[model samples]
Target: MKKRAAFLIGTGCVLIAVSASLAVNNQLESLKAEKSAELLTEAFISRTTVFETSVTEMTNEPVPEIIADNEIRGADEQASAKKPIIIDGQEFIGLLSIPSLGVSLPVNNDISYPLLKMTPCRYFGSVDSDSLIIAAHNYNSHFGKIGMLKPGDRVNFTNAGGLIETYAIAEVLTLPGDAVDEMIKPEGWALTLFTCTYSGTERITVRCVKEERI
Candidate 1:
């Protein structure tokens, strides 16, 4: 009888331990989502301020210089249009927005550890080129839900100078996890957003193309 009581107590302790662990995990996930959302909000506000200010300034100035023949105008145009937003010494290259996902995050050129967690980053290629690639973690509030986006969904990109460009989702792909190099070196995709799949065995890729420019 004593042995039976001890076994029962041990089983109860194991169950309590498991319950506590599950609770902690759930709390962590909730906190992560909240933090991701907060970061995205802050990024949007920051970029909006920069964009508006640049637009106001442009209205008062002469038209920008003409591009020379044979020059790559896409990247150069962006560079000449507006100055970068410096926050805590970090420069945000652009703004990425997807209304369907409720995401508007800053686009930084660098994808360092903590920075990516704060917001999305341009992992490779140029937004000016047809193969721009952006990446972020699959946090609950981050790019985790990008797979829900379907063809014809809209995605907006705002460069540093307040130039807004819109794109329509062309394809949603799940590539092998080991295809990181291939994913970054896109062929003709205008804009690409990627994150890891839930099982970490695949990469979710959302491709978009130019639809409108404002």
Candidate 2:
């Protein structure tokens, strides 16, 4: 009888030990999974942050060499024009960075066909006398995230004098491409962004107002 009792006690202890081990293993696995998810999120945020900084730097850069060609200048003007600072690279036109929506692009050039001939990038920033009309590709690979902008989001670019131009989102409007007349209602200097809507190719335009900045 004593031997039988001893055998039963030993069996109970072994089962308890096995159950405890399994529980610990499961807990460790759960923790590991959570850590992995956290790491992935951090990585994505970091990548976007870096992309924004890079795009902004690109925007702050001088004008593109293609546009700076003095050869076209009336032969005599090129000599005394102060060697027009010439810039090259896609970044010269890059100006805006939307982190929340993972968008960083150069908001340079007018809405004319000739500039589009310069590069296939999203274009904005006024030329001569006009408020900038920003346009981006509706495709997800480009500035499609502009649709995600909300009130208070930021829009940045640089002026002809190499000064950073900043604007804030005051409102978002879902309007037609021809609605261009309605976009200038913002109170301050503004950057009007337009693109095809997510559900359809209909243009989606959002205007951001300029706020105290050099």
Superposed by TM-score, candidate 2 places the C-alpha of residue 204 at a distance from the truth, in angstroms, of 1.3
N/CA/C clash count, model 1: 0
User: Which has the greatest TM-score?
Assistant: 1
Task: Give candidate 1 misplaced runs (Cα > 4 Å).
Answer: 1-44, 47-83
Off by over 4 Å in 2: 1-94, 108-130, 159-162, 183-189, 199-201
For candidate 2, lDDT tens digit of each residue in 1-214?
9999999999999999999998787466545433432342233224331222333333344334433343455645433221212233222333455545654443333344433322223344352223666665554434456777898876655332233456677777788656645655543445677777865547777777775343
Per-residue CA lDDT of model 1 for 1-214, tens digit only, reads 9999999999999999999998798568656755864765465455553354322222223212221111444676556544556666677777777877776667776888777767778888876676778888787566878999999988877676566667789999999978877786658778999998878889899999888655
Q: How well does candidate 1 score on lDDT at residue 72? A: 40
Identify the leading candidate in terms of lDDT.
Answer: 1
Worst 10 residues of 1 by lDDT: 61-70
Q: What TM-score against the true fold does each predicted structure earn?
A: 0.72, 0.48
- Quote model 1's TM-score: 0.72
